[model samples]
Target: MRKLFVLLISIVVLSACAPVHRFTQLRKLPREYSENYSIEGIKAPRSAAHRKPWIVYSDRVENAAYVNPGGRVKSAEVGLLDTFLVIKTKGDYLRLIKYNPTNIKHNRLTQRKKAEYVGWMHRSRLILSPSSITDVQSGLHDKLLTAITDTTAIMQSATYFTTADSLKVFGDPELQNQTGVVGIHAIIYALKHSVDKRSVLVSKTPSLSADKIGEQVIGWVPAVMLQEIGHQVFTGTAFSRVPTLQKTLKYAPMIYPYHTDSTCSFVSGTLEPVIDKKDNHVFNINGKRISYTRGNQIKQELKRINILFAMEQSSRLPEQYPMLLNAIQNLGPFFAGSGESFSYQFGAAVATPRGMETIPLTADYEILIDRLVKMASYVADTENTPLPAWKAMRSALELIGNTPEAVNLIISVGETGEQQENAPSSIVKTLNEKNCRLLGWQLYASNDDKYNNYVLQLSNMIEHYAEYRTKNKRNMILYADQFCRSNLLREAGPNFLMLDYPYASMTQGGFLFPEKGETLPMELFAGAVDSIVTQIKADHQLLSESIDRAFATVGNGKDRLDSLLIATYHLPQGVKPNK
Candidate 1:
């Protein structure tokens, strides 16, 4: 009797310690669902709100599931308050992962073993809903980042962070360092901006791996290292009216080379994408999730151009020299005030009593006038000297460097000094090489068809403003002169601009000064200068608008870009500058 009793006790102990029998197939859940099934009496939770992939808790006292759909029960029973990950649905049945209620509070998943069970059950037998289940909320708000700094740490948990070696959620995918992530130029929609003391919560969009579990909790990025986007100084001007760089990016591959079509390009190279690294991965921000990828920074471009004045000072027009100098001097304030981004440099083609030569550019308008004034006291006949004018144009191009990307502008003032060298082709080639534009502002001069034709031959683009003309002379014709109007008219592109068009009896528009005498009043010169300055401002504004349009159509196509450039620089037939 004692032996039998001892044997029973040993069997009971052995049975208690034995591993619970579990279906091997039930332990592993499918990542995706098959066909769904619905039946009467198998209803979703009454309080459930969100749609699809609904997670719910067992409301009943007894919840038993089978290894196969509607098959014999093969798992232990669960009770009220237990959690289940709804895997799939069949006729009157549901496949689920029965997990511990405590485990549901964390982003961590309960691996299918011990506390977690996976099986199929009659939908009517168990009840759950989305609203009935609550998830862990980190209680962090989004932050506006100015920049992402080096040493910024990526965290795996919102609660706490471990050593850098283990918490490698992202960074240097090459695994260059302990962190599994690397930083690059990136734009991101942040999920959460910052945590209490340590890191900012960023998105895992930059992840190459589709880590559904690891991707959700992007971990924490060091808060101190993340910079916020700053405000603009001038918000109303055309230069400043653009979307903030952060507002324009979508939640996708965070790291990408700078795109010319990017709205940020509209604002020039002032702002760039921010990349934050925690552990070893690049993260993004702006109240959304950020993804990382390999990309290069946007190239910086030339925003402003250098404006060089190539004014002619002839010995015959003594009184006109000072007037021209005064006019050029006054333009300094107008150019500066026009809000056009440019630097002004002055040079003069002086035909003094001694000889004719081009004066070098000066920083100060007064200094340039002083030097020219001191060069020659005597003024003689307006010699047909185009050498000095040519020299002035060459000097301007040299100052800015004759690169294909050059954007420097040349403004030639005074008499229509036609180049006697007759090398219009060479001039055109040089101008094309530098991508420069020349504005010919002829004041108090006889209408020279030769000079007009010569100016038209220059490459790239040209703007001629013929000021103060006689009754018979053509006052503001674009590239076409009186004699060669038919031939040269065919040569002009859409970019060619002329004021006062088609020889109106008297040149109309604002202050009018006819070529009555050799010398004109300073007041008339000032008006002409004002008219020219206004035109310059209008052109500058048009260029700004073109740039905005070009970027607006970025990613659209190359044809759109070409069209935009053409439309902005060149006007169609019958179209005139806005008066």
Candidate 2:
């Protein structure tokens, strides 16, 4: 009898780990509504300003003022600069290098013996501009381009990585290549020339903290960070055209559809309003928002409260939703991006784009690139002047799209091999009506080991199939792995993809979504389209009114990415570059 009990328990335990599947109810929404969300997949972005002319300058020749560039800053600040080369600029700052003098090679800047990098310097004190660049060297353009392309090629080869405090793979020498330094400048060059280039500069190999064995291990900041930036810019570009009442919500960095709320708690990032004795909900922190007129503040706070209410009401687990709603409704209007939920909504709003028409001249694209540069600049300057979130969020709000046709949520498809578009056409239709967009794959996943032969075939097909429609399926198919090996990337097309949540985590062999119906991703997102609508409709009138107004804006339309950038950074008025 005991043995039977053990066997029965084992069966139940294993079954619990499996995914649960349930039928998604189809909503009778307009066909256009559903189609709005059916966004075609885009690949990783390629640079349009490939051969564009650019210039940057430096103030002092001292090498000691250099910073460790790339991925949230992993390397310790090292020695100063002994500058020999000037390749690119981001805003006022100049990225300097020292390559061979004789050949003036552009393909790669062979690292000098002891001349360490002196990172970005202000334009206010530029040592050389466009005209002066010729004085320094006549053929600066070709040399810089070669350096950029070669360095980019080398870094794009990186595939292996570590999060924090892990031992570096010494066998992997590619990560610490001498040419990587050149590539870093190449990135700066590209970024300075065009604010919206989502280049896929993956490292040739995973090399993290080779010099430090015992220190906390994280992935190589340069390549990983560049890729992440690529994702953000691409997201901004794809979302630029989402249907909305106004364009205010369009083209900011795309947010993920789901997030792992810091240990799967029943929390919401949507701020809630606290109830008052008069039975009126005193939305917008009673006296906290003194920054704004109390009435407007109240309206904004109340709107967030409604959003939270919508979230709670949209809960798929029927058993726990009411309590969740009641508990939050009573405790409304806390701080923005705070509460029982996680920190922010960016992660939950993310969706991968396999392809899109990248309009390089658009204001949204310009804003997208500017925000990216600002974020990196802030990271590089964090030691002296840290940009606080409160101030930054306001500035970021300017980037939000104001179009009425923009989408609110994105349904990103899975990797190529998986039936990524398996969410039934009917369900997809319903999603669109509810103001959600989808990012589906260009092709199914490859069965070939690591896509070796398959990649060659696809590349060749694309090479010849450039102008043909029917032959190449779609001219721009998503490269199955957004983090595909450096060699496997497409040479052209609208290369734009986003690495968010489950996808980003999955690529690194970290956390991934559990089986369909049974997992939280399914429970949270499965019926959310209708649920969000249902709950929002029932929210207070004040909430709806505020959201309506926010949908339109004057200056730069504000959105979450802009908010994120604003929250994290603000240029200090007092600080100036060292002369």
Candidate 3:
């Protein structure tokens, strides 16, 4: 009897120590539907949301996952959260390595830090995609983000950063940073702005890559952020000044997730197909498990380019739908204010003059200006003219900008005393008809079309302003930037600086930089113009901050036009002052 009892005890102990049985497939629970992917190959399956770093919560395991296939269940059971850079998926299983979420909350980790791994978890346990979680912690009311810092959700979106000069993406912000997860409108706007800026990004360098634009632009923009703030200061007292332009971003696109159209190009995922009465698809937000079929699964792409992209590529696999949905529902412009403040308006304005040169003088510019005045009536709200307070503000902003000197940037050519940098005839010819030289730091020039393209941009804005005027409160800001850039350009000579558009976050949008058709939307033109105004005001602040933060990024000591002012000529170092 004693031997039999010992034998039974031994069997029980061994059973407890033996590996837990894991079926080839996980038990059916949430997301019963399944699929597989090639992990080590180029065709590894990943959703758009999963393509980037994402957050998830662990759940009560009905059937536990292992440290290894049959090892003891992992620790940190229910309340634990983590980030997974999912590399592969099969059935309900995801192949991944977990990174420290608790460490990220503490100061030990830099916000951009990744590349660490804990292990894997079942896909069913992902309570949040991170994309669906609001940056707002439920009921707390914070004004989205007035300023981004290291701990803010916006800052958390970045995985890497460098100085502005070291990087510059399309719209010139962080690239592939997974900012969409923040749910802040500005981050969304910035991400979208970065997405389709194919041309502007190309113009950024003779060539660019993930290392250049993505990492550096985010880092550099901050240092130069506050530099453009002075652009907003004017000669008026507080009373003389009307109300400040409402800092709200009126134009950011409303983003939501929904079923992608047949036009959506992603082939790795498919829109959840509707059958009889309901679908098994579900989107879990916070702890609430809701039917995903009812959400904003529809793709909201107003731009034809985006539409074409969706239609051109095959629809994604069912598993990739969430990613595809997030990709289409982009939002936010992010910065409310980003630069330095000045005491006097003119003192600041004169210090920040943008050098402008035209292709050749044209008589038609005056006609456009005349039409511009007529268009000004239409420039404000479609329902009414600008308010008295708005006019007071507008006049104050444009007063110095519309002078003959300001117009001269568009008309006359100032002489550059010295050809600081030599150009090949092709480049010189290109410079003559197209771009201006940025003779700031030491003598430097690139055969970049971005310079000449800027002139065309100015001409386009004036032309569009003359043609359409649908902006309500923002119309004045559009006029102000045009005026500001114009005045700054008057300070330029033929071989002068091209700094405004780039330093300005390339908010320089207007009428299509033409995709295919000659026709363009006045509304899009207006949106682009509004974007320019916002960035111009914002960049000054950003640059001010960056000048200190990202010091010596590109043109570290550049902006001292007063010291260089021997009548628009830049003197080499140690040159004596003009008597």
Model 3: lDDT equals: 0.25
In order of listing, the candidates' clash counts read 37, 91, 63
Question: What is the RMSD, in Å, between candidate 1 and the native fold over all Cα?
Answer: 25.2
Q: TM-score for every candidate vs. truth?
A: 0.34, 0.17, 0.21
Q: Write the per-residue lDDT of candidate 1 for residues 1-579, one digit (tens) a residue.
A: 999999998887775543322222222222221111122223333322222233443433445667778688566576533556665567766767654445433333434344354677775444332211111232122223323232123212221123211233222112222233323222322332221434433443422121242333233344543454322123323233345653445333234545465332132223332212211212121222211111111011223444565545433356566656666666666544544344344555555544555556554556666776665454444444334445455555555553323244566554444545243445555555554545554445345553443343331233211221221122111112221222112112222233432333122122222252333345644545455445444444443443333222321121111233234335343331111
lDDT of 3 by residue, 1-579 (tens): 999999998887775553221111111111111111111112223434222333333322232334543246663333222333343355655544444445333222333234343344565444322211112223111111112222221122233223312222212233322221111112211111122422111111211122233332221123211111111122433232343432222332223334555422221111121111122222221223222222212111000000001010011112232332233222111211221132111100000011110111222223222332332222222342212111211122223332221111111011111222222233233222221111111111223443233334333333333223212112222122322222112112232223344333222222122222122222332233234444344533433343233222322232222331323233344332111
For model 3, the superposed segments whose C-alpha errors exceed 4 Å read 1-127, 134-143, 146-408, 411-543, 546-579
Q: Give the per-residue lDDT digits (tens) of candidate 2, residues 245-280.
A: 234334433333444855322222221211111211
The per-residue C-alpha lDDT of model 3 at residue 491 equals 18
Task: Give candidate 3's TM-score.
Answer: 0.21
Q: What is the C-alpha lDDT of each candidate?
A: 0.39, 0.26, 0.25
lDDT of 2: 0.26
